[model samples]
Target chain A: MIKLEIKLMKNILGANDEIAALNRKLFAERGVVVMNLMGSPGSGKTTLLEKTLVRLVDKIKIAVIEGDLFTAKDAERIERAGVEVIQINTAGGCHLDAAMIQKACTSLDLNAIDLLIVENVGNLVCPAEFDIGENFKAVVLSITEGDDKPLKYPLIFKESEVTLLNKIDLLPFTNFDLRSAREDLITLHPTIKIFETSCTGGTGLEDWCTWLLQKVAR
Target chain B: MHEATLAENILNIALEAAKQNQAAKIFKIGLTLGEMAGVEVEALTLSFDVLKKNTPADGAELAIKRVPISAVCNKCGKIFQLESYNFFCPACDGILILQSGRELLVDFVDCE
Candidate 1:
């Protein structure tokens, strides 16, 4: 009896999927390309956005919805980067859900923005469960975080459309097995686009930027 | 930590399903939480108890199924269960790509 009950407990995700579909439709109508940037804390997600803002802010009107457990620091940084930014302080929340993101969207001028980047609260697990009305999910993995990360957190790697292996500049200092990580990631998600980047040194930004531009344009 | 929110989502889904089926009472709410889901089962149960009070699903039992983390190794082509935080195959130190078991879903419902 217990085994049967457990086996039937598989449809809960369908509920979340329904909500996500509705969100996807709403975003499409507005021509807003939403990217959910997910990563462990200190994976250089904000830094990448900051650097992008310096280069692309003039051409593409970008807005960010920063999800953090505490503090308005990230939002402030983006604001200074010359883009419309809103911060959703989840307090102790681990992930940013669609409901919370929908509320955040109200504060932005959606009509003027081409891209809406949601920097999800630094988590690889919980964030993958919730869809924050995004076109695609992006995962940032620092080389310092270990190459074994892709295998340990395969869901994030599989769910994400693009994986940014950030902090490559630190590879020389650390024993991060980049080849193994890429191989692991590719095995799980055959089509996932992997970008090697260092947000601090600005290496491999051009490829990432090009990918973002083409994706958003579509 | 976020188990409370997940419990809320479960209740929301149960309530919606109850409404959809026009069932007077929800007998059971089922869930499949994967091993790698990062959700604490104890936290979910505690949150469910608190949130279920006064709702139609108050007495409705929550059935949570735990799935083992199983992956297929790219190098060895062998299926094996993962141990601890290790996500690599023990046979050949190959990438253990998740094949199944990480099922965060509500498969069915028992209503009357």
Candidate 2:
């Protein structure tokens, strides 16, 4: 047998990165700010998006791509909020790939939107690994998930530019320690912005909306 | 869960490399996975085993090398290997800036 060694040195994420780069270029040309929202199931990602839509729909032209495993439940809810929404049912796939985002973009009129929010599949681990061509990643961590989440899933916390601590209204009911969670998040990501929010109570939604508006403006 | 997709990517890369080198068959593929990459080695190996069949890299051995998370201290500029999840610098106890441990690369391929 003959021997031949080829030093490829190719990145595993190279394929995804290329597609993501293309999506980023397209978004830039359309002058749209895309945000990839990631988190665990039941982390209130959908609720937070609804709350954001309620506040920003009047000021900014927003569109959403809701990713789920099987049902169009989240997409339907977003439709009620009255913004242009598209649903991507991964079927059995755990994460949304760049190719999927590219296909989804074909259906959207990007030129009409100011902000495009891709609500990634409700998985903290896999979604963080794949970049779907967003300006930045924002993770929603409900207080009920416990403060140890930052340490347990450091990659998601580390990869995210902002962390929204949702369900703050349930803090008194649960044993979640906000201070310890903040400290842990700081250790994992030195400068990550943290937002405490309760979608139902309207707590911290104003600040979150203000920050999002500023990001879109920039 | 995503290991299967990752394995497919690895196979694609191997096939492309083998074709570029004008090789008939691939023998081995070397991969570098960072400790914090969130990919399980066993799952990825299993995925490769199942997906490699009927491809140019069929029966090829996959060798994965795991790299520990390393960081540089921002305050004192000290480089250190992190043993645990805590990212504090050992020398200065300052905020540690991650230097490595997020890599997933197809390092090389052996073919003939």
Candidate 3:
């Protein structure tokens, strides 16, 4: 039997990157700033989105793409916040790929929106690997999850442009160390922007909203 | 799992390369996965086994190479391999800048 060798040094994620590039082009053409929000389950991703929506819905036109394994519950919550919402049920898929975002983009009124927030399926691991064509990735880590999370899951922290230390209101009750988390984040990513937020008490919503608005404007 | 999806992508890449080269069937596929790529090797192998049925790469052997994380020291300008998760430079104990770790690529494929 004759054998032939094909030396192809192609990236396995090349397909996803191609589609992500297309999505990025579409976002740029439509003048939309997309943010991919990722975190673990019960990391207050949805609540933070809800708070952001409540604050900026009147000032800026916004849309949301909520990703989950099952149910339209998060989408419903975002809908209640009075924003155009689309829910993608991955049906056991751990992360959202660029193709999903490409399909989702066709359904949104991109011309009427300034920002599109895609809440990734509450997974810190898989979601960080796939780029869904967002301007930048923002990772949410609750204070109750402990500060060692950054070292344990370095890929997510390294890939994210911003880190939201959520549930700060529970910090007094938990054994989480804020200083260690900050130092770890700084080590992993020297220039990562960090925000401390408490959705229930609304501690840093204004700063978060202002920072996001500046991003959308750009 | 994401491994299944990743396996599918790898199969697609192999098939596409085989077609471009006018090869009959793929015999071996080589992949490079970084230590910090967050992918489970056994799970990816299992997923490849299940998804390669009836395709050009049906019985192809997969060889995966794991690359350890490496970093360059920003302060001392020393490059070092990171055996552990600590990002400190071995020479000067400075915070090392990550050089390689997040790579997932199909290096080569053998076909007939």
Top-lDDT structure, candidate number: 2
- Model 1 reaches what TM-score against the true structure? 0.79
Off by over 4 Å in 2: B88-94
**Chain B TM (all candidates):** 0.88, 0.94, 0.93
Q: Candidate 1 or 3, higher TM-score?
A: 3
lDDT digits (tens) for residues A22-126 of candidate 2: 999999999999999999999999999999999999999999999999999999999999999999999999999999999999999999999999999998789
In model 1, pairs of residues that clash are A9-B31, A9-B107, A10-B105, A10-B106, A10-B107, A11-B106, A11-B107, A12-B105, A12-B106
TM-score of A-chain in each prediction?
A: 0.93, 0.98, 0.98
- Per-model interface RMSD values are 6.8, 1.3, 1.9
User: Lowest-lDDT window of 10 residues in candidate 3 chain A?
Assistant: A1-10
Give lDDT tens digits, candidate 3, residues A46-164. Answer: 99999999999999999999999999999999999999998899998999999998998888899999999999998878998998889999999999899999988888998899999
User: Which is the winner by lDDT between candidate 1 and candidate 2?
Assistant: 2
Candidate 1, A52-157: lDDT as tens digits: 7787887787899999999999999999998888999998899888778777877777878899899999987789877666889999999889999887877788
A93 Cα displacement, candidate 3 (Å): 1.0
State the lDDT of candidate 3 residue by residue for B7-111, as single tens digits: 999999999999988887998999999999989999999999999999989989899998889989888998888776666666785778878887899999999
User: Interface RMSD for candidate number 3?
Assistant: 1.9
